[model samples]
Target: MNQEDQELQTEKKGNKVLVVGASGLIGISAIEAFLDAGWIVVGASRRKPILLSGRTLEHIKVDLLNKEDVFKTFQKYKDITHVVYAALYEKPNDLVAGWSDEEQIKINDQMLRNVIEPLIAVGAPLKHVSILQGTKAYGVHLHPINIPARESDPRDNHPNFYFDQQDYISEAGIKHGFHWTVLRPQLVTGKIAGALNILPAIGVYAAIRKEKGESFSFPGGPSFVWELADADLVGQVLLWSATSPNAADEIFNVTNGDVFEWRSVWPALAKTLDVQTGVDHSFSMAAYIEENKDVWAKVVEKYGLLNHDLNAFIGQGHAHADFAFAYGAPQGPVAFVSTIKLRQAGFFKVIDTRDALTEALQSFIDRKLLPPSIA
Candidate 1:
């Protein structure tokens, strides 16, 4: 047999894994990677299974919000050895002020009780549990002390669902007897088959503007810094965390190991989409969306898309916009460990940020998640 065939045969010899939120961007990649490594994977999603190749995969419809459903599913796979938790409620635009504090707490608190707590209680022979988290846990609006925010940075004083969920996992994991690892990644992007990304939204907007022969502008100032990480790299980290002895009961910050000013990334994106960049106008996403309410409406109406409440979307969008442009000006290069810790533990894979972005954009085109005009 050829070397390629021999390598594939060797990889088909690993362990069994159970992946929650298998339908999400990161989860799908994790499932694929684990399967490629020769692990028997059982994926649970609220929807149908994602088609995968090369390994045995079983998909089950699971409602993580329902305790009984979660329990029943785990009971069937009680013998499974590893668990990856990637399921999460999409952060609502109104998460900041629209909902009552009590309401927000209740929804997030119950998710922990119904899902994570049960896994802990069952004490399934899980050698490790890797929980997916984001940079938002550090605080959405507050300026982080450094550009590459470290895992040790103090969390924002503001309370939110992510903080609550992190607390729940920390508390529950300690009592439940499994080694737990948390991975906090910043803005993950990659070749997702049926996923949407903030970058693509920009691409689509730029594409439409180009098709209509209109100019494009960058909203928010150009000074903000946004850190981007590849979803495939994040998946690598997840698998590494699951098996690495150093990662047990610890949290790690995952990023692309570099920070980019939005000005640079935005224009690069515009160039990739063949759209005109730098139209000499600037506004925060909030102000732009508000001022151009009619324009956004026209775009939505022309495309026959669902009308997203501009005011609300803009509120969250502006926070991201502000961070993208202004975050690192005050903070010197945010000194977070990119794969430093993981590498020390012998997991040394690295992802090229530009290539990751290009591959992701192409995947969006191939899957029709975004239009060809955008490419």
Candidate 2:
């Protein structure tokens, strides 16, 4: 074990945790992580999960969007020692460009005021409340000054709902007397029992292209860079934030230490799948969609897919092709907190990026969640 892992092994452990989004990707793994550390976990989700396996775990049905449900849920579990808010109204695919700022703000603000504040107000024995914020909190469309974004960096000039939500949590924690920490994770990829993720989406796309004997090309420019963090790493960071004194009241950027361009990742994934990878004739979203729309339509029809509206299904507008292509290209390194900071403070656990990705992919396959083509 490295210094970070050693330090993590020594930190004080909390007794019970309330995971708000226990059914989501990050929440699922985080619940398990807390349980592994001997913390009693109470998971709240709109639907009871069929795949979660744990004897120490309890499940509660609560609608976070409903203030009454939020309050009732907290009242039921006021003795919980920690809280991890992984639930959000949006999904990763919601890339609609035409969404107005006011619409976004109203929805996010209500969630915080209705759900977050009540939990803090109850002021049970809560020692820590960890909120899972994401890179968009910094601004969804703004470019970062530094590749890896740090917690202290100035947020983008454009206001976003995530920023407002973070502000509410911070202020509430201060007034309600609980230690609060915000975890800002970028492009989280991991294995989930009954959910989809970016990695799986990419893998399924590649598998379909291969079955059709189509060449795969880098979707966008080669200059775009993204820092990918495994879900396990983010889960560990969440656990550490809730229990480690060093993380109290601080915001940390959780990301894979290494940065890679799509040019590298696309080819690497293609090779792993033993398929031909080539650039598309046109990388523009408009052109690609226009060209492949028929193909995708046929696939959806053949499979009898329930959610088949590509634009709405993917949460991108007609401009999705453009955003998809643009996000694919390497932009720059996203700045983030060095594990050294946490390690030096006596929390030392680091995840190997390659191992993390491989394990995540294998998990998809093991769970039979891989698309038929890939299987």
Looking at model 2, residue 177 earns an lDDT score of 72
Candidate 1 has which clashing residue pairs, if any?
A: 146-334, 147-334, 148-334, 223-325, 224-324, 224-325, 224-326, 225-324
Quality of model 1 by C-alpha lDDT: 0.62
lDDT of 2 by residue, 272-319 (tens): 555678855435544445456566666565655443555433222224
Residue 164 of model 1 has an lDDT of 69
lDDT of 2 at 123: 59
lDDT on C-alpha atoms for all candidate structures: 0.62, 0.63
